[model samples]
Target: MKQKLGNIFGIISIISAVLYAVFFSLSRKQFTETFLVYSLLFLCLYAFYKLSKHAFHVNYRFLSKKWSGRFFNSDVLVLVLAVGVICRLLLLTYTPNLSQDFFRFIWDGNQLLAGYNPYLYLPDEVMRSGASPIPNAAFLHANMGELSSGHYTNYPPLNQLVFAAAAFLGGKSIFATMLWMRIFIIIADVGIFFYGLKLLKLLGKSPYLILLYFLNPFVIIELTGNLHFDGMVSFLLLLSVYHLLKSQQIKTALFLAYGVLLKLLPLIVLPLLFKKLQWKRASLLCLAVGAIVLIGFLPFYSSDLIEKYSGSVALWFGDFEFNASVYYLIRAIGYEFTGYNVIETAGIVLPMITFLSVLLIALKRKNEIPEVLLSSIVFSFFVYLFLSTTVHPWYLTIPLLFSVFTRYRFMLVWSFVVFLSYYTYSNSQFTENLVLVGLEYTVVAAVFLWEVIFFDKNNLQKTKLNSL
Candidate 1:
């Protein structure tokens, strides 16, 4: 018995070591590095993750030792979290390699600290006028990419406020600003680790499932290494749902509104409230959320804020395309018929489909119960991404949060294959290979279909199969 537990513990340690090495490598490697190297390392990291997950479940489900045992579960949980933090600390000082969005992050932050509205001032115009308004404006404008430099920042007010705080604390040193920002992100991740565990337990799930998100290589790389704040958004979203399930309506409204201010994506889940809380309570919740969101935006309000922000967002649908699934097929068909890219039409149409799909899922799915509500939220996000004209890799963080509560595993699968879309960055043209895109989506779609169609007989949820 000791030997068996020791072996499982050994596997867990080995998984953590490999994850450390993988993140160390990713922090040093640029996106321009060969796609083969990125794919190989990511695939290898994922293999260990799967192995560790299997080992964990096998030890818990079959062994006489209770995975719920206070000492055992506590030690393993600490090991999982300590590794997660160690992996993040390794990249705390490194510049973001996977995305240049952080350059714009600092740009926005400095703008706020400098008393300039990020949404009102365009980086390109700020630079061309020979005015160095923001600290390190020259370097930031040069590297923030033409697409971002030309437009007003679309990051929400709370997000920009975070950036502002970093800018104020970091002074003129980009590394310092980055460090502060990374610290915030890491703290948010830690919050997610604890809240996610609590939420799983509240949902009657095995708390061990939080490891699926906490220790994911994809999450560590994207959210921590790349300095994206989707982790913060995820944390807030989780808190909102946690409180909502406990019938703490005011707390739920506050957290959900904060999440919406951080990133408007959480708005999609509002439809679920109608079914779960019913029309009257849900309507009041929506009104409360709306008031909070309005207050968040009021501090930075201007006539141009809405128009500029909406136009910048519209670019994602009308002008940009990447890692898309159904929209790509529809795009190819449009090309065949009209000999022109139809993102303009598809962008408008696909969102309508996504909204209606969300409505259908919210209304049709059995969501009055907490478990079904959680799963229904995941299903809606899946449909939204399925029909979205643009699907960034970090966008998967939403569904990944729900996987701990539900049987859906496609989010984990997608996290692995989504790196294939990075093949475009390997070259100067930054051209996406449709073949890689198709292959990535094909695997994700297949797994999604299978998981949605069939429940795992031995699903390591909250079930007790002690007689087995």
Candidate 2:
């Protein structure tokens, strides 16, 4: 009877949270106090359910083990998350404005599929010229009345190519194009979730940790509901790490190369590949993989690829966003953010120093794939976060996903808190607002504290099976 009650409460809490978040997102593209109230209410109910179940009595092994009763609990959590996703998709079709980002992507894809260089034009440009037929097309018409510098198209070509393919398949229907591309991302997210679960299991993650990540409302809503492609990059990275764990050195190199192709940010993990292997072997692997990636990208690689690459690299050091690592710390202290270059120089140098230290430790440490992947993800995430000019909320998924591999439950919680803030940030609802900024910083501080101080390492270790 007690267990049944706990289950009922858990389900109710999840449903409530999902409804609140989805409704809040649709209403104003912002999570107001009312939404937070609902969130808190569900949180309280969830806490009560957990207490009734004596979550403390649940051993880490029971939580971490794959194919266990705990896994069923996780499945229930995922089902609730799926409900959130359904709400998001329904809103995408039914809502008038849908998403600002989605609007931009569809416009860009149409340009590409129409035999025009989308990289050379912004949506506002085409909309003003009466080129796009999508509804509320005037919403894209901007007051600037100037051509954008085409800098935002710096994202890798593979993403744009996939978007173009979707647009082509949808013919002239804008809604169909957007839906198809969104579905593609959703499919990739499924791969990320299941494979991520398997990876966590391999890493000796407790079933609870698996539940923490897989069933986490934040991950599901962001990757599945939002139809974000960050999941593809994350999936590729996890697969790369999995290959490396199996000691498939060449295959690992290829996988990592492909991951970087999907999203260039994964290149940061390259240092880890070299850290353990012989110099000759690492050099050969890098050369082979680099060749493959370059060959695949030959269609998009022009003579100006070098110039474009340099511009993209330089763009990172030109600005500081408050949500980023260490930059938030600096910004919180009243320091003005200069160009991305200046801060990135400092950010990159410091993390490289930290990376060297961690690499030395990693060499001596009996490392599992989960540990290595987690360390790399965290290290690279902060390094780029502090250094990069752009820090999108979806980027947070990179490190957050790997936390499960390390059986870090707090990361899952932090991911959700950060996810909640994303709606406000992306919509510019709280842009430069002091109160929202403070709230964000407070959450960041809490995450840092929870992960560094509160998380128990021994408890994580105890959850692993001997065979693992």
Q: Write down the TM-score for model 2.
A: 0.74
Tens digit per residue, CA lDDT, model 2, 241-260: 87777778877887777777
Candidate 1, pairs of clashing residues: none
Any idea what lDDT model 2 has? 0.57
What C-alpha lDDT values do all the predictions have? 0.82, 0.57
Candidate no. 1 TM-score: 0.90
- What is the lDDT, from 0 to 100, of the residue 2 in candidate 2? 42
RMSD of 2: 6.2
For each candidate in turn, the TM-score is: 0.90, 0.74
- Candidate with top lDDT is 1
